[model samples]
Target: MHKYYLTHLQELESEAIYIIREVVAQFDRPAILFSGGKDSIVVTHLAKKAFWPAKIPMPLIHIDTGHNFPETMEFRDKLVENLGVQLIVGSVQESIDKGRAVEESGINASRNELQIVTLLDSIESHKIDAAIGGARRDEEKARAKERFFSHRDEFGQWDPKNQRPELWNIFNGRKRMGEHFRVFPISNWTEMDIWNYILQENIAIPSLYFAHQRDAVYRDNTWLPASEFLQLREGETIENKLMRFRTLGDITITGGIESDADTLEKIVAEVSATRSTERGNRSDDKRSDTSMEDRKKQGYF
Candidate 1:
């Protein structure tokens, strides 16, 4: 008989590292999609481990909606400086100013949808043949079907119905010129796995993830951050809530949930007991049942 020990988190980490190495070996100019979010930070750490003797051989690309939390931006800068890695930012503000994307006009207007154009433009301008993101399978129904090596067309469009099958560990990254792939090394991780990894590795994340008191407006069943981008519309209630962001996006649309999970252990407990998915706080997904699918088809990451 063979002796064995089972640790789910360790197995997942090993798989993620293997995918990271495959990205470096297969793509010509691959870049990581870092958003200062917990998942992205985990992917960055895995990439670091994948190439311990040598530095992580890729840049990080962030599609800044320009309404991100100040703490997230601070974390992004600090991580880049500490890791000595190149950081590239795609600004939605610049895209709007250049008329490449128009700002939506409404009380709940957000740049969440507008980010797609800027992201695709950034990818094209940089000639990034492969982009590594931190999307997980358990995050959403649409994402659950994603493979580690998801392909995109010349225009960066995703065809959900037509994805390559992965029978084993072999990945088919072959694509014609002007085509690319959006790789998700952590595609297999669930929320619990992420929290566990963060706890085990002692990884530092922005304080926004923890519960804290902040001024928020209760609208669209979410605690929208009281930023300049968000306004107090008629019949809206403002309150001082103890909230923590489940997922980070444009300040106008990313919602906060009431919680007191102020530590990693507490967060793990919270997510373990949670009912809804992380993207549930996002109103952009509420635009339509297939909202994420529609945007991802147009190159939204």
Candidate 2:
């Protein structure tokens, strides 16, 4: 007798593909939110695999905070061109210029929160009924409560307590007009799972993920990249250090950790031995315990 069972990675892949297909079937217009981060890259790859021989049926959406790393923008353009997929950029700078959103003040202020307005405006302009993202439950406490098919209001607001439940593999994507949904295909994947999948598939990630020498400052117990967008505090001093970003976001607030894990194998080993969550180094999350929750409530991606 022979019994067949899928490995953990295979299971995750299968689940994600199924979610992608469901989005195609359920929504009139759907798009994958591509941030050029590892998670979004994996999500886009799954979308590609989900509909082989046929190009992915949806465009990729990017909410550009305008404070992005140059490397991230380069990667985004190259990937979109290689895939031959449509790319939509929602510019926070445009939102600010148009007075739809205001920039935060002070040295620690980041445009991370301002992205919500641009994201919603883009969704409305494009008439996208569903937006697929690479968000994972294990990344944060607020995200942990997100459903595979998360429902949003006409204003794109997310009510965590009112989310639809997923039983077995069944997902309900029902919503009213002027409203939309946020679909997370990789919601079940973990940091280790992402690294392992990337390693297994030999996916290309930004060079910032690997160890390199960069000018950074130690603040709030994390290595904040020293960029022109970053406003240094009084006591902070820029110094060259070997570091790698555990996660990517606005350059102003995203922090890196000191490490020499240049190769994927070393990165996997480092992740396995680490005791901190990936978002621990993110200054945006450090603002308050409920910062992510509050943002999600206001329709942040």
TM-score of each: 0.97, 0.98
Per-model CA lDDT versus the true structure: 0.89, 0.93
Q: Highest lDDT among the candidates is held by which one?
A: 2
For residue 98, model 2's alpha carbon misses the true position, in angstroms, by 0.5
Lowest lDDT 10-residue stretch of candidate 1 = 1-10
Across residues 165-239, which tens digit of lDDT does each residue of candidate 1 receive?
986889999999999999998988888889989999999999999999999988777799887777788898779
RMSD of each: 1.3, 0.9
| Position 27, candidate 2: lDDT | 96
